[model samples]
Target: MRGPDPWAAPPPPAPGGATGLGGAGSGPGAGRPVSWGREILAGAVVMAAVAAAVGPVLGLLWERLAPRVRLLVGGDALYLENPESQQAIAGDGTFLLLGLGVGLAAGVGVFLLRRRSGVAETAGLALGAGLGAVLAWRLGELLEPDRDEIRELARRLGDGAVIDAPLELNALGALIGPAFGALLAHFLCMALWGPRDPVRRPPVFPRWG
Candidate 1:
C-alpha cells in the first residue's frame, strides 16, 4: 500500500525568500546612498560644461561693451588700443551676473530632479563653483593670446584711438563669482525647498536611582 502524504501543503519560502533576477539597485544609491564620489565627479563635469559654453558668450559680451572710437583722428592712431578701463568694469559685472545665473539654474535643475538635497547636491555646488572659476580663468587666457601685441599697439598709438575687438577677464570674477554663485544657489535651494532630512538620532533616557 502507498505511504501517507508527507508533502502536506506548499513548503515555506526558505530564509530570505527569492532574490531579484538582475542586480537591481546594485550600485550606489537609493535610501541612504553611498555615491558621494560619483556625484562629485559628475558635478565637476557639469560645471566644466557650463563654463565652456558660457566662456564664448562672456568674451562676446566683453567685446560688445568694450569702449571704442568710431573715427581715427590725425594722431589718434599713435596711441590706439583696446578699451582697458571700460572693459574691466563691464566684464567684471557681466561675469558675476552670468556665473550667479548659471549656478542658480543648476540649483533649480538639481532640486527638481532629486527628491531632497543630500551629499550629492552639496558636493555638486562646491566643486562646480571651483570648476567654473577655473574655466573663467582659462577662457581669458585662451581667447586673448595677443596681449603683448595689444599692449605694443597701445604704446605706439595716440590716445583716443580704439580697438574694436578688445578682450579681457577680470581676476575677481574668476575668484569670487563662482563661489558667490554657488553659495547663492545653495542658500536659495535650502531656504526655499529645504535640505534633505538628516539621519534620525536615538532618544536618550535619564538614569533613575
Candidate 2:
C-alpha cells in the first residue's frame, strides 16, 4: 500500500445524506412549536377593541332613529300624552333593529377579513357586541334630554304641559339582538361556503380475466 497522505481531503458524505442530529438537512424552524393560547387571546382583544369603537356611532344613530315619547307634567307627576301611544315599544324596536343590522355588518366584515374564523373570533364578537350595545345605550341616553332637566322644565311649564321625553330602551331582552345577529351571520356563512380540507383516497382498479 502507498504511504498515507497527510493532506488528503476527507471522504465525501454518504449518498443518503446525514440522518443524525445536527445533520446537514436539519433546521431550527423545521419543528418549531406554536402558542395558540396567546394567539387566541391577542386576536380576541384586538377584535373586541375594534368592535367597541363603533359604540359612539351606534348611540348617535339610536338617538336619531328612536321614537320620542311625549309626557304631560301634572301636579308633581308626569303622565304619557297618549296612553295608547306605542312610542315606548317602538323605541325598543328601533334599537333592536339597529343593533341587528350593526351586528350583521360586523360579522360579515370580520368573516371577509378573516376567512379562517375560530373560537377566538366568535367569542370576541359576542362579548364585543354586548359591550358595544351597553355603551350605545348609555351614550344614547346621555345625548338625549336629561330626566332631571326635564323634570325641572316640567315644573316651570306647570300643569297641563306637554313635552317630549328622552329616548329610552325599555325592553331589556332586546339587548340580545346584536349578539344573535352576529352569530347568525357567522354560522350562515360557515354553513354556506366555508372551506374544508380535501379528502385523499387511493385509486381503485378493476381486475380483468
Candidate 3:
C-alpha cells in the first residue's frame, strides 16, 4: 500500500467529542452573534405592515358577505320591511366572522414566518390585527350604499315600495374579534409547538469530557 499522497486534503474534524456523536446540541447557529433588539423591532414592524395590508381584502369580503336589511317606504318615512328580521345582526356577525378568520390567518402566518418568535413580533401581530380590523370595518361601511343614495332611492320609489337597506355593523364590539383571534392563535401555537426554551440552546460543539 502506498503512503498518503503529500497534497491530499485532510479529513474534516468529527462533530462530537471523543464520547462519540453527542446528543443533539445547539446546531451550527449557537456561536453566531445576533442583535435581538433590532431583530425583534424589525420583525414587529414588518408583521404590522403585512397584516395591515391584508385589511382591504377583509373589507371586500365583509362588504360582499354582510347582510342588508330590507326597508319599506310608507308615508314620509321608511320602516323595516320586517321588524323582526335579523339582517342587521347578521351584518355584524359577518364582519366578526371575517375578522376572526383574517386574524387567525395572520397569526398562523406570523408564526410560520417567524419560527422563533419574539415578544415584539407578537405585539406587532396584535397591533396590526386590530388596525386591520378597524380598516376593514370602515372600508366595508364605505362600500355600502351611501345613506344619501338610499334615501334618494326611497324617495324615488315612492310609497309602498321596498328597497334593500344599507349594510351596517351595529355591534362596535365586534371589532375586537380580529385582535382576540390573533392573540388566541398565537398563544396556542406557542404553547403547543414552540421551543421549550427559546432563549437557550446547547453548544454547537461538544466539550471534551
Candidate 4:
C-alpha cells in the first residue's frame, strides 16, 4: 500500500511537539543545580553591612557601660581607664572594626570560591565568626599588656597572681571580652540577614537546521 506510507507524518506528532515522548527537552520535572558560591557571598555581604552598622553603636554603648560592667565583671582587678587607657581602648575598638571588615571580606571570598559547589551558609558564617573571634581575641591581648592602667593593676596584684583569684578572673575576662564581642556581632549578623542563593542559567544547545 505505497510502502506503508514511509513516515506517515510521524504518527500525528504525539502531543506537545518536541517535548513529547523522545523529545530533547528536559521537561517539567528536570531542574538545574543551584550554585553555592553566590549564596555564601550574599551571606557575607549581609553580615558585613550589619557589622558596619552595628559596630559603632555597640562600641559607644560598651564605652558607656564599660566602667560599671568592669566593676562587676572584673571584681578586684578592674581595668582602670585614664588617657592612655582610653587611647588603648579606642585602639581596641578600631582593631575590632578591622576584624569585622576582614571577616566580611573573607566570607565573601569563600562564597565566591565555592559558589558552584553548594557550600553551606551556616558553615561559612561559622568560619567567619570563628576567624573574627580569634582575630579580636588576639587584638585584645595585644592591647591588654600595653595599657598602663592594666600594667599598674597587674603590678599591684603581684606577679604570682593566683588563677583562682578574682584578679586572674578579671584578667581572663579582659582577654576574652573582645572575642566574645566578635562572636556576638557575627551571630547578630547571621540572625538579621538571610542566606543568599546564586543565580544560574539554563542550559542551551545549538539549533540544527
The candidate scoring highest on lDDT is: 3
Error of 3 at 78 (Å): 1.2
Clashes of each: 5, 0, 0, 3
Query: What is every candidate's alpha-carbon RMSD to the true fold?
Result: 11.0, 10.6, 8.4, 12.9
For candidate 3, the per-residue lDDT at 170 reads 82
- Candidate 2 on 92-117: residue-level lDDT in tens? 99989998988787777667776766
Assess every candidate by TM-score. 0.52, 0.75, 0.74, 0.32
Q: How far is 46's C-alpha from truth in model 4 (Å)?
A: 18
User: Candidate 3's residue-wise lDDT over 32-75, tens digit each?
Assistant: 56788887787678566746665897899999988788999997
lDDT of 4: 0.42
Model 4: ten consecutive residues of lowest lDDT? 163-172
- Which of the two candidates, 3 or 4, achieves a greater TM-score against the reference? 3
Model 4 residue-pair collision total: 3
- Name the Cα RMSD for model 4: 12.9
Model 4 ranges with Cα > 4 A deviation: 1-85, 117-122, 138-209
State each model's CA lDDT, in order. 0.53, 0.77, 0.78, 0.42
Cα TM-score of candidate 3: 0.74
In model 3, what is the error at residue 169, expressed in angstroms? 1.7
Candidate 1, TM-score vs. the true structure? 0.52
Q: Give the CA lDDT, 0 to 100, for residue 86 in model 4.
A: 42
Clashing pairs in 2: none
